[model samples]
Target: MLFAHDTEASLAAAAELVNTAHETPDGLRTPADVVAFVDRWSYTGRVAGDAEELAAVRAVRPRLERLWHADRDEVVELTNAMLRETRALPQLVRHDTWDYHLHAVPPEADLAVRILVETGMAMVDVVRLEELGRMRICAAEDCDDVLIDLSKNRSRRFCDNGCGNRTNVAAYRARKAGG
Candidate 1:
């Protein structure tokens, strides 16, 4: 594993969160969508399950998306800003299937705030280990989704939205046509 389990999970969650903004027809278009996302990510906190909550969650996508294309200093600035905005106070907490991991906000905090703080804390590890290269944008020509390159060889070049398979298939078709 390139990073601690929590860090890797957070990175992935952050990527998925960012990609939601780029999805066709808007992924988080309803409270139900937000609930599904929270469940998928195993987020343990107050989820208002209301329109305001959904909008707040959706609002963070662009901010988190910036990390994929940000320089080291830019990432630091953004991460720090997130932490500052949330007034994050890190503490080790173990809940559910998760082992000891950092939780910088109360379980009752706003869902959006928790998401931002958790992602910021994960970026803290990435910046500390000089592994910001793991953060990347999809290499697929038609996709603008963000992805985390957690592979040991850093070979990940596409988002998980079938871009890799689609790109490979297109290449094969082009090769067949040329031959």
Candidate 2:
């Protein structure tokens, strides 16, 4: 794997969270949407299941999104800022079916803070390994989604929202038309 399981998971979750804001209808429109996101991402913590909690999580999307397009130094600055802002204290912990992984904030911390800290922790590994290029914006001509290229060849140029397939199909059709 390009990164540890937890780091990859955190990066993927962060990307999905950011893409929600880019979705046509704004994927996170309600508390239920927040709940669904947490459940999907397998985040185990104190969930308030309220509007405030939903708003807080939604507010974090843009900040995390910036990391995808940041330069190496900018990523370091933003990640360090996130860790500091969240008062992150990294510790190894095991929960649920997950093996030992780093948890920088307590489960009871605000969900938004947890999201930021988790992403920051993951980015720490990315920065350490000098793998910042793996964080990328989708290559689809009309999409603005972000993705982490976990592929061994580092050829992942599209998000998981079917942009790759769409691009491929368009290319095939254009070739057939020209032929």
Candidate 3:
């Protein structure tokens, strides 16, 4: 694997969290949306299930989204800043069928802090491995979503938002018209 299993999973969740702020219908517009996101991500912690909590989570989307575009050094700086800003303290712990993994913040910390710290921990692996290029935004002409190139060959370009299929269909139609 390009990274440890947990790191990859956390990175993917971070992308989803950032992307949740976009797309039609607004995936995180309400308290219900926040609850849905927590359930979807399987984030185990104290969730107030209130508007204030939702807003806090939304506040960090920009920083997480920035990681998709950061260079090696930039990622390092951001990761370090996140770790410092959150006042994280590293601890190895196992819970809920999870094998030993680092949990740098208490479970009762703000949902945003937990998510950011988790992402920061994953980025520690990314920076150490120099795999910042694997984090990327969709190359689809009209899509703004982000993704991690977890494919063994690093061939991931467009996101799973049907962009690949849509692009292919458009190209095929153009070819047919030209012929």
Candidate 4:
């Protein structure tokens, strides 16, 4: 694996969070939506289940999205800011079929803070390895999705939500018509 299993999971979760901001129409417009998202990510924590929690998580999405195009120094600064803001203190704990892994906050911390700390810890691994480039924006011309390129050959160039397939089919049709 390009990174620890949990790191990869965190990265995927972070991307999912960002993608939610780009969702059609309503787009994560409620606290219940936030709760459902946390449940889907298996995030264990205290959620206010109110507008405050929803706003905090929505705020985090753009910051995490910025990391996709940031330089190493910028990424370091942002990651450190996240750690500082959340007051993260890494502790190893085993839970739910998982072996020992870092948990920087109590399982009952605020949902936004917990999500920030977890994602920051995983980003620490990426920054340390100078592999932040693996965090990328989609290559599709009109899409703003973020993705992690974990492929050994670094061949992943688009988000998994069908943009790549659509782009490929359009290119193929263009070629056939020009022949």
Candidate 5:
């Protein structure tokens, strides 16, 4: 794998959080949605399962999106700010089905803070490996989804939201019409 499983999972979770902000239905519009997301990601933590918690979680999208096109230094600055804001204290923890992985915040921490710390920690790997190019915005002209390019050949150019298929079909139709 291009990155460790934990890092990849964290990056994907981060991207999903950002995409939720721009999704057609506003995926995180309610507390129920937040619960669904937590379950979907299989996050083990103490969730308040309340409106305030949902809002806090939703607010981190833009901050995480900053990493999509950021340079190494910029990412480092942002990550450090996130870690500082969360007062991250890295601890190795094994809980649920997960093995030893870093958990900088307690399970009782705010969901948003936990999300930020986890994503920021994973981003440290992206920066350390000098593989920042793998973090990208969707190439589809009409989509602004964030993506992590974990492909073996670095050929990923679209989000997983069917943008690749849609774009290819559009291109084919245009060529057919022109011919």
Candidate 6:
């Protein structure tokens, strides 16, 4: 793997959170939607299940989205800000079918804070390894999705949900028509 399994998972989760705000008819506009997203990502933590918790996570989406195109210094500042804001305290523990991994906040912390801290901890690895380049914005002209390129040759250049294929096919048709 290009990074630790947990790091990859966190990156994927972060991307999903960002993409939730992209090009959708109804952008993450409800608490139920937020609950579904957290459940889909298996993000375990405390949730008051109120509008406030939903809003906090929604607020984080834009900041996480910025990482797709952030410079190294910007990413570092953002990461540190997340950690400091949440007052993260790291501990290693194993749960479910998973082996040991770091958890930087108690499971009872605010759900948004936990999610931010988890994503920030994984980003700590990315910054340390100088792998922030692996985080990317979709190359499709009309899409603003985020992606994590974990390919061996660093050749991944698009989001996984068909934006690349659609863009390439459109390009091919335009070339054929013009020729």
Expressed as tens digits, the lDDT of each residue in 54-99 for candidate 4 is: 9988988988888787899998899999999888999988888678
Candidate 5 lDDT by residue in tens digits, 1-179: 88877789999999999999889888799998888888988777888889999999989989999888688899999999999989999888887888888889898888889899999999989999999999989999999999999999999999989999999999999999999
Against the correct fold, how does model 1 do in TM-score? 0.98
Using all chains and alpha carbons, the TM-scores for the candidates as numbered come to 0.98, 0.97, 0.96, 0.94, 0.96, 0.93
Compose the digit string of candidate 1's lDDT tens values, residues 46-91.
Answer: 8999999999999999899988889999999999999998999999
lDDT of 2 by residue, 1-179 (tens): 98999999999999999999999899999999999989998997888889999899999999999898889999999999999989999999998999999998999999999999999999999999999989899999999999989999999999989999999999999999999
Quality of model 2 by C-alpha lDDT: 0.94
How much lDDT does each candidate structure score? 0.93, 0.94, 0.88, 0.88, 0.90, 0.86
User: lDDT, candidate 1, residue 115?
Assistant: 94
Question: Whose lDDT is higher: candidate 1's or candidate 5's?
Answer: 1
Q: What are the root-mean-square deviations of the candidates from the true structure over C-alphas?
A: 0.8, 0.9, 1.1, 1.3, 1.0, 1.5
* lDDT preference between candidates 1 and 2, better one: 2
User: What TM-score, to 2 decimals, does candidate 3 have?
Assistant: 0.96
The residue pairs found clashing in candidate 4 are none
Scanning candidate 6 in windows of ten residues, the lowest lDDT window is 20-29
What local lDDT score does residue 38 receive in model 4, on the 0 to 100 scale? 82
Summed over model 2, clashes come to: 0
**What tens-digit string does per-residue lDDT give for candidate 6 at 97-151?**
6688889999999888888898999999999999988998888887788999899
Top TM-score hit: 1
Off by over 4 Å in 3: none
**Two-way TM-score contest, 2 vs 6, winner:** 2
